[model samples]
Target: MFNRIARFIPVLQWGRTYDRTAFSNDMIAALIVTIMLIPQSLAYAMLAGLPPEAGIYASIVPIILYAIFGTSRSLAVGPVAVVSLLTVSALAEVAEQGTAGYGVAALTLAFLSGAFLALTGILRLGFLANFLSHPVIAGFITASGILIAASQLKHILGIGAHGHTLPELLSSLASHLSDINGPTLVIGVAATAFLFWVRKGLKPLLKRLGAGATLADVATKAGPVFAVVATTLAVWVLNLDDLGVRIVGEVPQGLPPFTLPSLSMDLIRALWLPAVLISVIGFVESVSVAQTLAARKRQRIDPNQELIGLGAANLGAAFSGGFPVTGGFSRSVVNFDAGAETPAAGAFTALGLMLAAVALTPLVYYLPNATLAATIIVAVLGLVDLTILRKTWAYSRSDFMAVATTIALTLAFGVEIGVASGVVLSVALHLYKTSRPHVAEVGLVPGTQHFRNIHRHAVETVPEIVTLRVDQSLFFVNARFLEDLLQDRIRPGTDVKHVILMFSAVNEVDYSALESLEAINLRLKDMGIGLHLSEVKGPVMDRLKTSHLADALNGRIFLSQYDAWRALSRGGPSTDAA
Candidate 1:
């Protein structure tokens, strides 16, 4: 009972092992991550079309909740770029931005997502994430990165623009070009260029300047903080806000506010699908990061437990005056690299954020929105990898089609459409491929028990016997295909007297497929041809034993293809098999 309870509350297990060394390491890592997350939390909230404080609120309670329930030791939970983009997309459909309705809808979305995720975890349905193929996910993320960057261009240019799709954003930006503010544009461009340089060159330069590796890494992670400070100071000292430089003015202070999401059925019905999608995407991304980090330290990450953790975090967000959030890849990697020892690092990070909320809210009033836009642009651009298209294209045509369609649709339409299409496309492609499984004709190699495809290798075969290798499991979708294939191959032949099906690759035989197999056996028996099966897997054999097909088979089942060959050949003359 305790173990079961501890699974739901992971802190109980890891807490016993916590020592001074772990505490010290976690505190240092938390301090560094907290420094990085402050500006990030504020920027992502803006990206989600929420007040800057919403982002801070998201990072605080979510991090603490995940620390108590999450299984990963290093994963940092907060408002991530992709989830933020998804949040804004989902929220825009329900209410206008910067309104009470918008805030309520955001909370409701987070609540619904949390409930769904927690229920899924309780049901141990983590395998459902497999339905979203990696190729499609890669495509969606790549497209989302492009969309996020484009969406932020308005703030970068100091103009009013709003759109969810690439064309809409470009058109909006084009229409507003005449109203671009010069000082805002200057800060945006400079901050963007500097951030790019810091990401690529600063670590190497700092290392060369006699800084230790840890110092260089810490300094590199502080790049955005430096940008925020410099830009905010510049705006404050030079009074750029008066000259049309937009600022993140008058952010609320203190910790996250207590609130409640709406319970309207209409609102729930409207937001459920989007909430489900967000939960699935967030879960997949978080598990991936957790697994990757855990592998480095030989730790374990329970996916179902991760769902519970994330669900708890989102539930925290829903009641804390924030939007949807998840484990951020960049922040988690920073946490891991900074020598975090347990989820306690995240708790400490939450404490740091709480302190910032109390003491640091006034400092960012002069922080230019252009700088935040620049920060978002630099951060999300890292997620845009167009090479996935080329890579998928070169690997599998079907995968290429799914990925290409996802990217194209995401760019032309919005994120919701793009992800929905990607899921449908992936499933369609899987069914298409599975419905036409490969069945190869085989012949025995001259001097061994091995069998090879007749067309590919020089092999020996008897004129009266034919052997086929089934390459896929038999199921309802492809059962008819397999039946038709066998019937077509065994035409009113002149010399074929025996047929053997090599079941080496057949892992399943559903009822529909079993019926098809029975029909095939009866037909073969009527044609005066013996039918046989060889090398069936254990579980498949067990399933078949429950049916009458084995007893009604026209010919005996053999343990191996070679055993069938030896029994049926009767020392027949061998020739080149075609």
Candidate 2:
């Protein structure tokens, strides 16, 4: 019972081994991630069409909850660019942005997403995330990054624009070109260029300036804070606000307030699909990051437990006056690089963010929205990797199709449709491939137990015997294909009396496939040909034992393909063969 309970609450497992060394490592990681997440949280909240303070609120309680329940030592739970874009898209259909209803809907989205994740965890349905193929995911994220950067351009130009799709956003920006504020444009352009430089050049320059590697790395990571401070000072001192430079204004001071997501059926109905999409996408992204980081440390992550952890975190956000949150890729990488030893680092980071909410909210009052927009642009720009198109195209055309379709649909229609289309295409592609599984004819290599494909190798074959290798598991989807293939192979005057199936590659044989096999057996028996099975897997053999097909089989089940070859080549059963 204790072990099972600990599986659900991973903190119990790791806490038992906690030490001062762990605490020290976690504290250092927490400080770095906290510094990075402050501006990120605010920017993401703005992107989601919420108040800047809501982002900080999201970072606080959600991190604490994820620390308690999540399995990844370094995954930082908070508002991420893609999830925020999705949140805005989902809520836009139900409420206008920056209204009370919008804020309430954001909370409700978090609530519904949390509930869905928790339910999936409890039901052990975490494998459902596999429906979104890696290529499709990459495509969706790349398109979303492009969309996020384009959407933030309005803030940089100090103009009004709103849209979920790329074309819509571009069209809106085009119409508002004359409304761009000059001061905001200057701030936005300068900040964006500086951030790009900081990301690519600052670390090397700091090292050249005689700073140690650790100090240089930390300083480079803190570049956004530098931008925020410098830009805020410029706005305050130069009276840029008077020149129509939009500042963050007043962010609420204090810890996140306890709140409830509205429980209206109409609201639930409107947001449920989007909520589910957010939940799946968030879970996929979080698990991918967690698994990658854990692998580097020679650790393992339970996907179902991760679902529970993320579900708990989002529920915390919903009740704490914030929006939907997920494991952010950049922040998690920072935490890992900063030496996070356990999820405890996330908790400490939460504490640091809470203190910022209480004391540092005032400091951002003069921080221009252009600077925040610049931060978003720089961060998300890293996600736009068009090289995936070339890579996937070189690897597999079907994968390229899935990736291309996902990117195009996401850019043309919107996130919801793009992701939905990706899921459909992924499933469809998988079925299309598996339904026509590779079937090869094999014969024995001279003086060895090995078998090779007849067309590809110089091998000896018995004139009366036909050996076939099925390369995939037998299921309803490809059962008829197998039957037709066997019929074609054993055509009119083939001089074959024995048909041997090499089951070495087959992992499963479902009911429909079993029936197909039975039909094949009956047809072969009528043709005076014996149907034999060789090297059947233990579980498949066990399953066959429960079916009538095993009793009605026309020939013996051999322990090895060589054993079948020896016996069948002699045209009778061998007594030496068990």
By lDDT, the best candidate is 2
- Candidate 2 stretches greater than 4 Å from native: 572-578
Residue pairs with backbone atoms closer than 3 Å in model 1 (clashes): none
lDDT of 1 at 340: 98
Worst 10 residues of 2 by lDDT: 569-578
Q: Poorest 10 consecutive residues of model 1 by lDDT?
A: 569-578
Candidate 2 vs. true structure, TM-score: 0.96
Candidate 1, residue 300: Cα displacement in angstroms equals: 2.0
lDDT of candidates 1 onward, in order: 0.92, 0.93
Q: Give the alpha carbon lDDT tens digit for every residue of 101-177 in model 2.
A: 99999999999999999899989999989878899999999999999999999999999987889999999999999
Which digits, one per residue and each the tens of the lDDT, describe model 1 over residues 236-305? Answer: 9999999999999998888889999999999999999999989988998889899999999999999998
Q: What is the C-alpha RMSD of each candidate to the true structure, in Å?
A: 2.8, 1.8
